[model samples]
Target: MEADTYTQSAFEAELPIPRGMARIMRFSNDQPTNHVFRRGAHYWLDLCLTPRPEKARGCYSERWGPHRFERLGEIFLVPPGEALHVRTDAGDNQASIACEIHADSVDHWLETPLEWTDRRLEGGLDIVHPYIRSCLSRLAEEMRHGGTGSAELAAMIAGQLAIELARYLEAISESPITGGLASWRLRLIDERLHRGGSTPSLGELAELCSVSIRQLTRGFRSSRGFTIGDHIAQTRIEMAKRALASDDSIKSIAFALGFASPSSFSYAFGRATGVTPLRFRQRHLRGRE
Candidate 1:
């Protein structure tokens, strides 16, 4: 695959097509940048890979403030004509990938109701699923290497991405957001949890949402089928899985996630997955062999 290189404003983008229904590009910026991504006719996916995942920040809507990212491999979907503003940390070179997929390809794989095709799946959809991350990582590697069979790999990944997006939309529809809470507040809670912040009390959550505790609890339960505390635990486990896969030490990950001690973290992890963190990491590592 050949690369289409260009520079616009302060950022440089390299777009490469390797025989697929998706167009993939990598972007790099040396300084803080404010650019509105003009939408095309197709749906889009963007993933940030630089400035350390934890330090990444961006605003999907022009009206909203930027927020710190909680996990790596988070996927943001951009609907046509909608603008996304991204400003990376200063003094660090920012790296990201933006892939544009044709709507027809998505429609073919998605089994959900027909109306969801028009829902847009909302931008800034955080993707913490390991399987999706694995597929995207392979697609990215092929995009960079462009070796033999790269075209086939790219096409397969493109189709897989569409399938996953459809499944995600279906899941969201099953737990549609209820009234009584602002969207920004929900985003705030998500950001705080991903940053390893302590699980917030019901009163704290209610105050942030500007609603009574009972209403907030009822709203969350109705939408997610779980309490806020359970959601926090689940999020922390997901983050822990990512961290464990990295080179970071288990003790460090435990502390980063706000656990009282390494022992406590191990206990919690064991209880959640029926295996120790070390054993889980080892199993995953072996599977990669």
Candidate 2:
């Protein structure tokens, strides 16, 4: 599909990665826009950069084959040779990153011929995968800031994306969806938390699970027998322990783990483990010695 077909959104940037192309788009229209693609020759994955406002009227309703869904603040994947129709309502100005991967790259990653009948291959909308999200987010960031190592990083990310996409397809195909957060959803939460960077907020985690904040909290509690906040606190402490083992300073680790300040991290760590971070590290080093 030509970029100009949808006047509501404009292509802000496009970059070439290994076996694919990535583009950033910005939507600034006041009216709803319609997009139709007739059996594209490549796999398309789009990640929303700007989330939809809670009270916004804008949303994306997509039709792929016989399946139809309405979603926002989630990644949309369209497999090769699938007719896709999308209607996007205008709301807050939004930006998205789209990556188009060639069919050969996908097949190569899978090491087998593509199966069109596989439900996993019939990608629709609101696909939730944390690893894919991390890769695409990194890709978008690299494209946004073209630097000396951008090309190498983009190529590496594309390769990782291809592998993750294949694995995700296989996993979803074999796994059945159930009530309350599934095993995969829990894994998503774990992966996102274990990912070393700023911790994700509750809303961000909800969006990652393709559910509302309330739903995520209730479902997680029901399934895990503990609150999501509890899980996050525990995970943060574990991460802090690992970082403390390293030579990095506690203040840096605190900021990296989304703590407000060194004092706050110390308080939380002490509450969780009955000792301050420095004390824990001292004990750990002493044991090693």
Candidate 3:
């Protein structure tokens, strides 16, 4: 696709690499906007250069089979021939570096035919790979400052990026994810939990992580060495402890923490800490005295 396809962002710089091209785009809009990216004959790997505003009404949403959104510092990869629809909310000031690598380059790097039908190769919306991020950041820095031997440096970075991407695809296609949720996903989960009001449901958490409930459960356990429910309970208990240290009434704290009732909150607190809320607060007060 042509660079003009990204009308939401202005092209700040472009670098023609070996069998690929990289461009930096800055998105600054005052109103919500939608952009459709038609599939082209190249793989598109984009890295966000700015932090997404936490309080924005709606950040970035994609329409690729399923609706998904991406966060700050996350990567979104679109395979060749796969169309993408993106919606950005109002008041978004974001910058990104996109590298468009031809399919031939990918095949060469992988030393195998690209499998478009493979679910793993269908591309990801929330990719969190450290090496890829580092490569992209290097490219961004180069693009920002075009000095001596910049072209050669950009080409080298692109080659490393391509090889790294190939390895990532191969690893995912060949093996199952036995690790826990990525740090970004975990941060999202924590954000949802502390965003105030009621605790998020399992389904909500799964949706936030862009995984099925079963996958989230298994991945969380594998990564955290504890169940997600256990983590949530622990978080609630910690919040309760902090609230107890204040002058807030136990009933209000219980209600604020999404417990059905004070009795239920006390029961959970006692079960978790081996002490009632009142006793915990009294102990803290005594310690202060």
Candidate 4:
């Protein structure tokens, strides 16, 4: 665990004026002084964060949840038109670098509108979510070295980040079809498929939801985008992908996912995914670029 504590210098003239489309700035053992701010048009962000070096203390900002608090390692996405108060810090240890970006850099990929508000990653950052952290680090490097020619790089990085965020949201949505709120059936279905393929039959699914097949199907249609069978197929393929990564036998994999016969599983996997199971595994593993 780390504590935040730092006294910042008095307000400097407002932040980067005539905001550059891409800007690189680093903060070390520093705090941002109080000021009112709102997201203007066009913005993306990559912040390098770490535990505060000094004591944990204060911040009075809507950019953060209100509190005289410790600075945690998280990033804020200030979208256009969102208002925020950048507050004074009461922490003694804090260090971060922010690469502020404009929306023109990522408009096409905005999936869930995780825009210009304070979005906090719970607990500590998952440096191992390589798809995400790698892009953030890459964006930082581009901001650092690309200099004035960083716009193109920023746009590229924004696209990658947006996709990762979409995937995360997708995962969240798909995790509660059987055991969540009534509105979350689709999400649960999607999450199960993503997790390890569906081992549940219609009877099993209905039992899990404590409903009859007819009623569940009606409700699921209103919520889940795909039928139970289709979703199961999707989940099975995803699981097969992971299985393929290992040296497991195809027959064994088929049995593991509840296929009655290896041939049936391979045929279904190939027909739906356009590649036989073994081929899919080899291609993905051999071509992991």
Candidate 5:
């Protein structure tokens, strides 16, 4: 429950935060700030107030991929005891309202052990979830204009946020197709695909993992609910997303990813993401702006 407001100067004000309760704080600054906790005891949700071309980077257990604040709202959930560092270089002020939900509150809602699990909204952070957005806006308004019922209202909203987060975590935790591939094997395959290497056939994958084709297929299907071919297709699609986010041409991306033709690539991409390659790139480019 500690924060550091670092700046080039020395002017800071203590926020009137209710101890051990959920609260929101407005953050808008050009400079970056790293907030460290000796031991984190809260689940934090940050809603971006201004969309930035360069998404902010945070380091918890690992350095996550670069993420843009989609127009719907970009949210991040921080787990207990994990230090948080926020780097904002959007060329303008990065404005966002963050809500802190204490661990005890989340524990009351969730029965699972979540001591080190941090999560963010998946699928490019373009979440148009009405409830999450509305709760953030209301909490910000209440914090801005405090009154007798403001505290109660803020607490209720924070509780709802915690509930939503717990539900999402629990749902995702119940994934049926996890822990299928070995970490090393998955990483090796991911590297080869992401580096624009040729797609490996079933035989090649079997040799790569030192397993027979039949064994590989059986284990992978049982673990991931998808065959090796499907895994490769999905990996290539993810690589296509990264390439499309950059200035790479669709044709070049298709060729580099080993797609037989641009049309084939389009079909596969649409099937994987429900959108065409051009559409995915266009959406990302718009988000950058």
Candidate 6:
């Protein structure tokens, strides 16, 4: 695993990432990515392999914390200004997921058939694993060959990578969120629809907020008139409405939302809207009921 970057130069785009969209990044031993530090303004996430540097390292939010973080395999929800830093060497190495998604993106996904958002998961290095290696290998191969639709293809590959990571996190950790969820939960689950958007199956989310699942979800029905998960779904439907008004493929939309496949996305979309995502988009865009 020598250091190299498929996105060798700064890769920037103004492309429309329909709601629920996601991406995956892999850093091997060969490629040493400088690993961008994220500003909430910049992107939703920045997964990296590079670890704390021996020398001084500053990032978008604040200076790298004075801690030694080796053996990198984690997904963390960085607070507004906090950043995880990494510097490479023999035992201490560079590897990570530079995933930057937006809240708008998460909302769009809810409209489709995805189960939950990263907000639903516990953020930690334990999230990344080798199960994704095969997929990443295929993506890298595709990147090496330039052709028509390469960028779009690259985007697709990246999206799947994020989906897989999300799945992995959902499967392994039983850790609940802790602390200060009053504000964090409100902000994180803002796509409110059914209830107050406060119930707790997103075990990872519980970990992120540092609160017990019981406190987060107890008697939520009496307060919100729906289950916490239902509230999350309704909020997702609201997000789907916006995507319906935009111009994007239903397939892309479903993928962004983390459907196991497009068929699932379509099925879920139809269930929610009484029409397919495309039909909903068309009907909504044309101002038809």
- Candidate that would win on TM-score: 3
List, residue by residue over 135-246, the lDDT tens digit for candidate 5: 6656655654667876666667776766776665554433444445675775566566557757888888778888788877876664433356755765576567667776
lDDT of all the models against the reference? 0.56, 0.68, 0.68, 0.47, 0.56, 0.41
Model 1: colliding residue pairs: none
The per-prediction tally of clashing pairs is 0, 0, 0, 26, 0, 43
What candidate 2 gets wrong by more than 4 Å, as runs, is 2-5, 53-67, 70-73, 121-124, 174-289
RMSD of each candidate?
8.2, 13.2, 14.3, 13.7, 10.4, 17.5
Off by over 4 Å in 3: 2-4, 53-73, 117-123, 174-289
Q: Residue 227 of model 2: what lDDT?
A: 67
- Candidate 1 — what's its lDDT? 0.56
lDDT per residue for candidate 3 within 167-243, as digits (tens), equals: 77665443444666897898888778765468779999999999999989988765543468866865676568667
- Look at candidate 5 and give me any clashing residue pairs: none
Instruction: Give lDDT: candidate 2, residue 72.
Output: 31
**Candidate 1, 172-271: lDDT as tens digits:** 5444455534557767777767767456677876777787888887776545434566667767776787677677889998988888898999999866
Q: What would the TM-scores of all predictions be?
A: 0.55, 0.55, 0.57, 0.37, 0.47, 0.33
Give the worst 10-residue stretch by lDDT in candidate 4.
117-126
Single out the weakest 10-residue window by summed lDDT for candidate 1.
1-10
Higher-TM-score candidate of 2 and 5: 2
Of 3 and 4, which scores higher on lDDT?
A: 3
Which numbered prediction scores highest in lDDT against the true structure? 3
- Whole-model lDDT, model 4: 0.47
lDDT of 4 by residue, 77-129 (tens): 34445544344444332223343445554454545554221212211111123
- In model 1, where do residues sit more than 4 Å from their true spots? 1-30, 51-73, 85-91, 110-125, 128-130, 144-148, 174-176, 179-254, 258-289
Cα deviation in Å at residue 139, candidate 2? 1.3
Candidate 2 achieves a global lDDT of: 0.68
